[model samples]
Target: MRTVTRARLLIVCLLSLRYGGHDEPAAQSHGLFCASADAHPTPFILRFRKTDRAVILPAYLDHIFDAAAAIERKNARRYLYTNNNDSWEETPFNHPSTFDTLALDPGMGERIKADLDAFSKGESFYHRNGRAWKRGYLLYGPPGTGKSSLIAAIANYMQFDIYDLELTKVSNNADLKSLLMQTTRKSVIVIEDIDCSVKLSNRDGADEASEKATDSNTSCKLTLSGLLNFTDGLWSCCGEERIFIFTTNFKERIDLALLRPGRMDMHILLSYCTFHAFKKLARNYLGIQEHPMYLELDEAMRKTSIQLTPAAIAEILISNQDSPDVAIREVLAAFPKDMPNERAGNVDGGKCQLSHNESKQQTFRQTMFVFFQKTKHLR
Candidate 1:
């Protein structure tokens, strides 16, 4: 009879709960026999839990509450929030970014998706491991490497809210803690530009307990220890199924403690563009499988060692959408012959790199066009 209460708590629980009552076990054993087939909707259940009536069931009356809705919560609306006085100021987040649209390596993209799946389904795994049911991601790369886009993609994929935690706006550790505590479960808590967010003292620099109570400097700096606690400490456990994403333009500038395994479980580095990435972007933007200029561009990149960001390459493709030939040729000539040889950096020193790089490409478009125009005469 108590079966009336907890269907979800049991079915999705991965068998964590202890079984109840003698007859309950029998009922579960013969659960299929107890099953009565009735139409039910994923978005809703047209039923009632309790029954109360007299006068011979009181001539039972019920209304057919039939309707249709999206089970993935599309109508529920995703939100983006910013910290405000220990509360979140919400707005509709309509970013169209998704894994499908992302210019990520197929393998890296799949791995990230799989990791998210495992984490979302890891309630029992987390509980059994005696750890908080949360995952921390550190996205460090030069700007314009799709760090923000990846964040959007992740939010869209998980159907989670994005809380853009601006540490500079927070007054103190208490303020930071309050903001974090106010966040709900299944949220992506993002702190972008972590290196530049606050001037975090070294691990051995200041006493965190004292720093927590201290004052405002250029809009109050959150200490390293405080940031650490925010990620891996007791306060972070307040919400379940939370994802903490910390982005830095320069990973080398970050403190060692913050880069630790437990605090930043996944350190993703979105790096410079590669031929493979260019091909994917080409497919997305130009709708071309193979371009005559691809081999020339690829070979030029290998020879001159000029690296570009996806954003930069994308700009070329977009700016010259009418002509794929120009786009590829311009991309080829964009790299300067005298530019220093750079290694286009590895995705990360961790298992998942931006799931996943090197550095920024914000000015690459302007640079590319100017370079192309100047070099066109030589071509």
Candidate 2:
């Protein structure tokens, strides 16, 4: 009877298993597994299937996951280069201010500080609402007047990199556009000698010299329209916060269209070094004070036809750096015997050329801390 009862219980359990019915143990607690399927499909997994279907995410999705995945892959792979170049190992640039090195024109410092502050803070009044971000400067004056130095100062002050774009290097308008696009924002893009770079529409053309009143399309290979587009076009607006400085010895040489109301925001005239500038240089380089020659020298400089540039004066100051007397003497020696009016054309034609005297170079290197300073004051 006991064996028959045991056989009946075993048959009952087997029949329950076959019908997919199970009884929980008396000690087992009731709870949920709490597992879920993926809420969204993978982009790659969806792409693998040949269907005109797409996976979309909510508008608020920041796409942080995709960015993280990209970063992870970048870390795993090494960038390969064909050439073994040590160029990347070059030391980082230690930006220095104009005050640390150069002797600048008086009132120049104040102007630069003001402009730089405006530029860095993104409040340069020229930038309009929803317009292209750029500033145009017409630095026109004789050579050795500090145009280049000013550029360096602006760059250093703003911690902005410089793109010294030579218009001649660009093959065409397209090439010019590519170079412009490659330039990073928060940079000063300089086009030195704009007057010489290309011919202007209003100017007398190449044929003008031979023929009487010739009109052979004064627009050189690079036209004024093209340059304007380069500065303030739809594509130009692509980059944000940039300054475009165009330096020229002859502002008149540039086309009128180039200097029109909206184009050149500021037309700064880097004139001859005045007595105030000279005094500043004296303090900077010679540390000279109330010398007996000061009055006489000032008078002489005022009367001289030689009309020394800030660069030329700086050269003299540097040469006589060790001996203030010597530097002043050199300046006096360069002074013209006859007092002449300030002449404009090619004023620095012969002045910038280095003499055979090694002393001049040595003095320049020793005395003037900021020899490469720019002439056009920004403020």
Candidate 3:
């Protein structure tokens, strides 16, 4: 009887294993492993049945994918930085100037856009030509001109970060090269007031040491040759799709090597305001494109020998934006009588014509002094 009982128990156990004893499947734990600490954390899930396998596994995988995508997006945003003591320091580059909003000549603006577009597409072209993918621009004009504004427009248009290089802060050539290397690809490196930044002369070791000892803070020992090498030399080729811009109030003061054909691919002269540029400002400030006084203002600007900058005109237009007639009248009255000859036709199409005559320079100084004095109240 005991042997029979044992056999019956064994048969019962085997039948239960074959037929499934429990009503639900056992719970199984799944782990979602992340590659980095910065990655989004995924929740643990317990799966039990064929239905759960069909729904829960796929949903968990999708969540992991979404988290990874979020991480990538957070890391992709660029920033503006400046060189500080041989290192780059991040700063806000929130400039509110675009190609449309910028007061640049239409033709010139279009050409700039075309050049940028071509450069952006010239990766294969660069490789084919065996050239470094870079371009340089020299923006030369007097103070209050739109050189800085133009730089801002380029940055905004390209959606690229700016690296405003302060050459004065750099200690030596090595420091300058290091700063350049730290910059990432696809950025505009701007050196504003390049003429005033440093003497930019290649001196002997004794002279360099004496200057360094005399005034370390004011004078930069970096030579013009060193600067050129950094811009167009082998080191520059390390980065691709880069733009270098040098701005100066005195273009004639800059070294010839810097203004050479290959060095500065384009030399944009931001000259005094023209009727065409004035129209742009009018449109920007006042909504009306064709006012009754348009003809009068056009004639007045044509008659005037003294030229005003775009900024000066913009100030006048904005002050009486509500009253275009008043603004036009004020601009006409403020126009100096014994003004210098119109510098050049339109900055966009015109070549830079620098006059080195002392008498002309003296006259310009006096006239500009008076011009600023009158506009000072407007500011």
Write one digit per residue (lDDT tens) for candidate 1, span 3-104.
Answer: 335332211211122224435446455331122223322222112123322221223221111111224455678899998756789999999888777777
Candidate 2: segments with Cα more than 4 A from true spot = 1-105, 123-128, 200-221, 336-379
Report, for all candidates in order, the number of backbone clashes: 10, 9, 0
Please identify which of the two predictions, 1 or 2, would achieve the higher TM-score against the true structure.
Answer: 1
* Candidate 1 clash pair list: 142-359, 268-353, 268-354, 269-354, 269-357, 270-357, 271-357, 271-358, 352-355, 353-356
**Residue-level error in angstroms, candidate 2, position 5:** 63
List the lowest-lDDT window of 10 residues for candidate 3. Answer: 7-16
**Candidate 3 residue spans exceeding 4 A from truth:** 1-78, 203-219, 336-379
CA displacement after TM-score superposition, residue 301 of candidate 3 (Å): 1.7
Worst 10 residues of 2 by lDDT: 7-16
Overall local distance difference test of candidate 2:
0.55
Stronger candidate by TM-score (2 vs 3)? 3
User: Taking the tens digit of each residue's C-alpha lDDT, what string does model 2 give over 117-191?
Assistant: 765566445465555666777777666777877777776666566777765544345656767677677777788
Cα RMSD for candidates in order: 9.4, 19.8, 14.0
- Candidate number that wins on lDDT, 2 or 3: 3
Q: Which stretches in model 1 have alpha-carbon errors above 4 Å? A: 1-72, 202-221, 336-379
